[model samples]
Target: MKEMQGELATRALPDLVRDLHAAEATGTLEIEMQGQRRKLHFVRGEIYLPAATPLARRLAALLAEEHSDGHELTALVQRMVDLTSSWREGSYRFLESKDDSGGELVGPLPTLEFARLGGASTSPEAAEAPTESRPSAPPGPPATDPLAKLGGERARWITVPKRSGSFDPAEQWVLEQLRQPRTLRDLLEDSPVPRAELLETAAKLAAAGYLRSLDRPRVETGAFEFQSETLQRLRLRIASFLEEKPLDGDLESQRSRVMELLATREDLDHYQLLGIGPFASTDEVQRAYEEMARLVHPLRAEELGLAESAGALTELFDSMTTAYLTLSDNERRRDYDRQHGLGPEAATVTETSPTAARQEEREELARSYFERAMAYEARAEIHFAIEMLTLATATDPTHAEYFLNLGRLQARNPNWLRRAATSYLRGISLSPREIPPRLELARILEKLGELPRARVQYHTILRIDSTHQVALARRQELEERIAAENRGEGGLLGRFFRKG
Candidate 1:
């Protein structure tokens, strides 16, 4: 059969999967939505592999452990299924296949099991369910070795609503000791009950959401306190860098001094530029950008009449902007980290070859030009801004942001529309996954009366990010207008034929 596809809004995902399972379908189900993609593979109704985010993958891996008793896996799978069922927007397609030999087999998750897992009655009911009906022995913890670590905080029982029944004797004893924070080791050493029984009871309670594990309290050297101190020191360093005595020279000499200051700075890496630590979250990067923008943005510099040092200040601001652009994007950041040897598996290169040194020098020079362009742009000197930006791109064609800025500047004039399109295309070619340049290019195409081409660009973007609201709206509007125009032309032709 041809591939079956539909939007999530029109069809419930769980029901669709259930239908497929009933048919004993063997294929891959691909989901695209909300700027992310996921895949579920089946071999004759059994899920062979599920590709998703790191957290989901890790959860799945845990559930796949050979030694895990069935109970833990069931609980984990139930949680996973519940989470997956919540997604409301997306498109899914299932492609049928006859052979599925290579993928890792996960489950032939039955419809009955899926329903049972998703059912509200899975948890014990206080009024109707018997206390003795609950597991006499606690189920094993999900695929992980629960007994591995100790000496942290003990697990405490969460308060439940008053019920007629009480926990069994062993569970009661465990809960009483857990009232105060004590490690597994402490509990094992002191408990009157057997070690196996106590551990099992604790695991079950935790899984049932009756118990929660707390972290051991630390002294003055807590991670949060250290981070705050580090941020304060970073602020001081930036202030010191920005605070330079008035130079004794003309405009040209001051400009030279500004360039010198920018080039000689020892801290310009992506993390340092953003005032963040390594592997910072996108949210953290955005917060740092906003904070730094208030301090070193060109508009702020202009308001302060720092014209003499505009070039230097602009460069500093652009460096932060570049940092934000790179770090905010998942793909670009990974590539950036890999190129600069900043990633986890970065290898040591003891010897710096001549080519590498030259490359570094070229990059520094390119940045200098880029910074000067930003300075000119801030002053409303459009001609000078374009010139400097052009030189920057010539010096470093690989820098996607340089091309993007150039394209934006070029796009202002009607006469230079083609050039703007070319520049945006170049930027897109350099960093295909970057969305801003593509969005700009689509708008440019639409303005140039290339609606078909613009639609193609918008569609491409939707493929990348299904939930891109702007693109979706624009595409829909364009389609409606086109349809209306076609109907109008058809009516006019019919009227003319009748007149003849």
Candidate 2:
């Protein structure tokens, strides 16, 4: 074959360049434009293609053009750059080639293999052995936004990035798909990998701790149990509060009833919560407040690090304070009683006296009309207050302070427990559905040793709110009492007096 070279041969040189490169032919190559020619030299593995125009020649030419300096070379080079970019994408033949004879022939030589022109031996083994190319994966189902497919329940999955290691790719895929509660089966359905093989691989990965365990998240029984324990503690506090006050013979029993009512519930009404029957003295109310406050006060919870229990602490404090406050005020108590129909009017006082004796009694009553009043004048019912103050004065007349206050104020002070118990009982009478008074009556009943009444109250409270504080506390106290008895704290008398 004749190899072409030089100006006449330059026209045919473009097509034969591929053949020369593949064949590893070495020689100088040249081309001409208009009447001028440029030579590019090649020696062994080295190539030298020199610039025909000076650097910055066109940029300078543009500046000169503004000044009307005529220079066509810059435009020509720019045209060549643009042409090269376009021709490379299309088919372009090497227009020069050289033979060992170094002849300047102009005719066309044979066509060259474009594919092998830039081929560098990848491996000696590849050259020796012809291996079959593996079939490529079918293009993935038209690319779609992965995020758009996640729907609403998307927080469950987390994105993980590519990493190193042989198992990394498989790990990443599993992690990406492992939404909580979504089993391996669901994950496999969405994956591109074959199910059987993927499952086998997934199992292996799980065994190696590279995949999540198949076990479902366990319910936290501890938290539920903790709540139950807290309720029990509240009941004990209520019990302790009542024990400090010795109520009227049956009042203790009534207080027990209230404790019983509150035993099983977490939230309790204030009036019924103490379990004291209506008409508790101010002293008893104060005592109950103190006892409960001691147990449930937010300040007390500092030891438990309750500061972290932001919500629970606030709720507990509010509930305890509210219960105490509601049962402590007389007017509120009376209103509550009136609403429940537990007014003192409901209790009938029997009279047994003849007309002459009754006439004498009226004469004496007229002389001391202030002896039995039920209203405080300072609070808008002077006559009622005077009547109560009169009686109080008669009882403790030696105290000048008592007499003056009674005469002036109509001392109609009601006992805290009495008012609370009255209110609670009224609540029960009015709304048998309500739980607080029932719980309170139960506690008071328990304190008075009326176990049956207390039990009924506790049962009722539980029926309404299973987690009543007094009820739970009483249960815990009873359990502890039992344990103490086992340890001989109550002794022989305790056993003998034990309720069946």
Candidate 3:
């Protein structure tokens, strides 16, 4: 195709970019707008500004200085989104002849979708705040508006030939007032344009290429908000709670019992799960169930206002109830023993069980991974963040908090909900006393349409903390939903039941 050239005023830069991307065009896009000349060298419609070139290197350096994010292409595209969104009268030429016309990838990035998510960022680990909500420092004058520094040296922000696009006499008069670089504060004080109208005009004129932001955007200090390992780890431990304090002895022991049941010897048969010999009598089983209840009930957690603890405790108690029910009957207990290869002589599991030893033998090299995972999350590098957290969980699978943190990050994206479910399951398995992961796991399960499993999760949570509003409400919702589904299936009993 012949080289294409057009005035930016006729077609916006983003639209032009979309067209180039749609056509999968291979070329160098040359743009002269907003009183500045720019070039975007693309290979098959993707940005390929190799740092081997001077322009690319300069742009890279500027992006590195201005944007805290490490992904160079993402930052560059974000800058393009910001600048191009306002372009009014600029000329763009697309030349399909380039050295890298072979379609070799520079980086698998800066796609149209990638550019859209650039404006906002959320840290997957520590601290949560929208970047747009934060105030930007005006280069010259103090303004209450987010788009501060209207005039003054900031006036040069529009660059020379501020009147780049065609404008009426009134518009020309406004440009004349801005000929001298000055603060927006002074312009509002001295100019005839109303406050609202001036801002509106400035925005409109800026988009039409009448004004240009000559300088790179100033990122506020500490915008990324990376926290220390100690603080972030503590935050992970606390889950949704704002404060962190040592657990009470009784609550801690109860949590320990739940963890031991959920994780340490999870391979046990029902008899072993209930901590009894295969031939234990009904009374013995009853005694064991009662003892386990006292150890695993959420009442202590509820009393201490530990919602997280209560959630996990509730889950443990549910399992104990199942085990109790199964072992309490002679036939079910015998059937369970046969399935698990246990006999009447099978001994109770001891501290030296192979499962516990295997857990203890896992590597503890997750500190570095944890640190990088947070940094990657803050940069919106979800893939890298997931990779790092996966490594962390694998290397130190015993750390309940690590799994919890990983699940939290995975839960941020809808596509990752399955992975998030796995992570939460692992977290609760490792630290069966933590209520947050259980609640999250149930929520994710509900979203995934695992209603029965979610209902069980909520039921367990209620077992620990009877007053849990969300669990109570969601469980009722799930009950109704499941019942409705049963009715649709033509079941005589619309009040449905499901196995965990």
Candidate 4:
């Protein structure tokens, strides 16, 4: 194809880009303005390389100084697009080429997102406010605003742009809710946040191409009218929120419960722990961390009189904090994903540290032994089962499951209760989030007539899982029993003093 050349005086850059995108053209776009030249490579209409010039190098250096990774590249592209948009005297040419080497940046650059970025780049104040533009009411027979147009229909997510730094909590919440199509009215009813804030967030999201209205023309004038069904749903939600009572059990039980849960589950990586997918924006990670911290922090535990479980809560909080720190840093997040086989080049990459390899090997051996132990237990060979479980624990002391099983087997004999408790403690130390080992230990302590210790364990379990039926029942029963015993002792002392 012949190279297309033009002057910016006659043709606007945004119009040129739109034309190319509409045509699905693939090639390099070269722009020269104010004695500076930049090359942007396009692959089938998507922006593959926004800047292939000395400017990109300077941007890279700046990003390095700030300890950022992919965000700098995105910022540079946005800057270039913004600059090109305003150029009144510049020469532009599109060179038709089959070269598809540039793959670092992956964005189709939706028209809406491009427009928003342009607006953001131009006005500093606009960029600071997430919701600045309101869609003009479409002119027709019946007047219809953006919200009116989206009245009965749900908004489905198309794509979400990666964001850096802190995000508005309301915006983040709205984005999460938009993972699936939800109507504006539904969101208003569901979210405890202000209706105005939610509407603003939804409007911004729709404008950014992150959301698309399912139906264009649907309106109910009295949509907010109180209906019986809607009232019932709202009531249920309110009740659930208000029903969250404080931990009623003791601290030790809560710790055991958490440990037991940790033992049965497969180990979760940082991304999984934060409840986010790979390449999630730093803002998303921080929001997730903060939400989790509110539920699992030691301060929350202490408030509920579960202070004895503080050590367990602290370990969990530390791990979560580490995950947040690693994921918030661009370079560190990339390296972590790469190491965990979730990176873009993970399929082709075969990199492993010596320590990691050894750990994996030991875990495999421990699993094999654990399986054998389970088989022996199934056959009713208690001695052989214990021996195999011991091997598993010795092979991979870090494996919570191994220690949990060993503890359970040892607890079968009353004479070995202390040893079983010790084993459970080890498992808890390795995996603070596991709950089964901790639960078993609490039961063992109770059986050994250690009421105070058992009470702590029960409270700890409730701290981790408030709706745990066993923990709730045991804790309540223990409290009643302790109260009755105290009352009986007081009566006996009173009678004895009166006789004297």
Model 2 C-alpha lDDT per residue in residues 435-484, reported as the tens digit of each score: 55466556555555445445556655666788777786775665566566
TM-score of each: 0.28, 0.19, 0.31, 0.29
Model 3: per-residue Cα lDDT over 424-483, one tens digit each:
766776676656778988888888877866777787788778999999999898898898
User: Which candidate, 1 or 2, would have the higher lDDT against the true structure?
Assistant: 1
Q: List the residue pairs that clash in candidate 3.
A: 88-208, 151-182, 151-183, 151-184, 152-181, 152-182, 152-183, 158-212, 308-435
The whole-model lDDT of each prediction reads: 0.57, 0.40, 0.56, 0.57
Q: For each predicted model, how many residue pairs clash, with residues at least 3 apart or on different chains?
A: 0, 85, 9, 30
Clashing pairs in 1: none
In model 3, state the lDDT of residue 39: 69
Tell me the TM-score of model 3: 0.31
* Rank list by TM-score: 3, 4, 1, 2
Question: By TM-score, how accurate is candidate 2?
Answer: 0.19
- Candidate 4 lDDT, 1-500, residue by residue in tens: 45578776555555556555555678878889767776666777655533444444545466456565656555555654443443446788998767655555434444324544543232445333332242221232222434433442233332132222344888778777754345564565455454445666667665543444443332221212334464344334333533464345544444444443233213446654555545456788977766544445555555646578677665565555567667777777666654553422222212433332345555665576678678879999887677667656644555677878898889999998876876776677667666666688789988877665676677777878989889899889888777766666336775676577
Off by over 4 Å in 3: 1-364, 489-500
- Candidate 3 lDDT score at position 50: 52
Best by TM-score: 3
On TM-score, the stronger of 3 and 4 is 3
Which digits, one per residue and each the tens of the lDDT, describe model 1 over residues 283-374? Answer: 99888776664466444344445666676676676566566667777877766664553422121121333332244544665576678778
- Candidate 2: misplaced stretches above 4 Å? 1-267, 302-310, 341-500
Model 3 accuracy (lDDT, Cα): 0.56
